[model samples]
Target: MLEEEYQPRRELPPHLRKAPAPEAPFSYELRDAVLADMPAVREIYNYYVANSTVTFDEDRKSLREWKSKFTYLQKLGMPFIVAEAPSGQLLGYALVSPWKQKRAYRFTVENSIYLGPAATGKGLGRVLLGELIDRSKAAGLKEMIAVIADQGAESSVALHEKFGFTEVGRMGRVGYKFERWLGTVMLQRSLK
Candidate 1:
């Protein structure tokens, strides 16, 4: 055996390598978000904002804005969960927020979920959303909503269907991005 061939490999540079998407068994536990989770949460959320229609914003959010979001969730007593691997890394996050600002809209909320690049298509998203629904119902919310970008074209819609959400409305050319307009679809799942 050549001595040089026995050495362990070091981390490869981005251009020369690929990383595996994180996956675990279909089951994952959810916990309340904590201050310590801000960095990982910011990283995962910004990744989607930068690379996909899962989030519509063109610009990544600052840490201060992240903190403000966290504060809003806290004030609403909404569930903000960080899904974790058995080894304890933050795999993804799911959250619920006020569907509309009016007092009449207080009983409804919108849910959002995002996974790290390496964590997609592994069934983790479904688990996080299921948990979020349970939390919303427990909080006495009447309906859970999903507003999906037309270009999203992924499980964001399918997952909602699996949970019994029905398409309630659609808007044509409601969003402009990437030099074009995109439609929007809204789905709602009744909790009562």
Candidate 2:
């Protein structure tokens, strides 16, 4: 568990670009995910699936299937965790998985984080990600990658950068969503 600490960044996304102050983050819990958390975890991810191309998951998973997904991550020894409010409401979830299926790519993992729609902009992403990076390092992972969906996906890309992730690649117009073509940005952070 991490105690409250704040470090404001100079660059912020357009929506939050000119805000005069940072919001106080709520007290939250971060812990490894159990099978029972799939429902709430899926609920958090479902919003992005329906509204944005942040995730390419066109079809959402049922609890049974989601459990399988979690099981697979466990088999790979990847970390899957959630952030929750003091009242036990899930605020967000994050995990690291194989960056690629090949054996040579084993040392690198792709990271994903989804804050509850109402929970965005609270600086909790940094808190969860800070811990995520720590855990990955402890697990002996060498690198972590983030394949963010679009140039406009600045908040997430910036979050990664804040945690020492650097932009490694960009492929334009790689995905079609909401009747528009979107670009993909790849960012990397070393765990060593």
Candidate 3:
């Protein structure tokens, strides 16, 4: 796990934090996520965990925990990237990791994505996912899948469809939060 004291400075400009308008191009660059991205990544993720159903966990995670997660992904040789604006502010990030630890499941991986609040509805998620899929395919993964919260919107479903992923299954009431239950949806895209 990465140390809690780890805080890598993003080597980009500073004006990128401006609130995005309806049509500012929503420009972003897809690049490998470095140690410097942990703070922004943690901010985006914690917001979701606390206010949205994107993930099932209830307790808010600490920076140390996020660092450990990044460390784990690095150790697994997984592909992780941050979507950044011209000034280096992070828009979002995506990654592919093993779906299961069993050797039989090594050929398959699951996908995850999180975008900054201001960056939503700007199409950055789609671009980030496209880059991630290309990298995963080039890495020789046989299949890539997404496990999304059942209550997720059509945009998410459509994004996967645009990339050739189709609904594989759904688990009812698999997650409980905000005083309610939510379903889990699984979708997959084949690289082979």
lDDT of candidates 1 onward, in order: 0.85, 0.87, 0.87
- TM-scores vs. true structure, each candidate: 0.83, 0.84, 0.84
For model 3, the local distance difference test gives 0.87
Give per-residue CA lDDT, model 1, range 103-138, as digits (tens). 999999999898977778888888889989998889
In angstroms, give how far residue 163 of model 3 lies from its true place.
1.0
- The order by descending lDDT is 3, 2, 1
Model 2: per-residue lDDT, tens digit, 1-192?
344565555776789767668766578889999888899998888888887788877777677887899999999888898998888889998899999999999999999989998788888888889888988888889999999987457888888888888999999987887788888999998898
Query: What is candidate 1's TM-score against the reference?
Result: 0.83
User: Model 2: residues >4 Å from true position, as ranges?
Assistant: 1-25
Q: Write the per-residue lDDT of candidate 3 for residues 1-192, one digit (tens) a residue.
A: 479878987754667666656765668788898887999898888898899888898988888888888899888778899999998899899988899999999879999888998899878888889888888888788899898888865678789889999999999998899999999888999988
Task: Score residue 92 of candidate 1 by CA lDDT.
Answer: 96
Pairing residues by index, what is the TM-score of model 3? 0.84
Model 1 residue 111 CA deviation (Å) reads 0.6
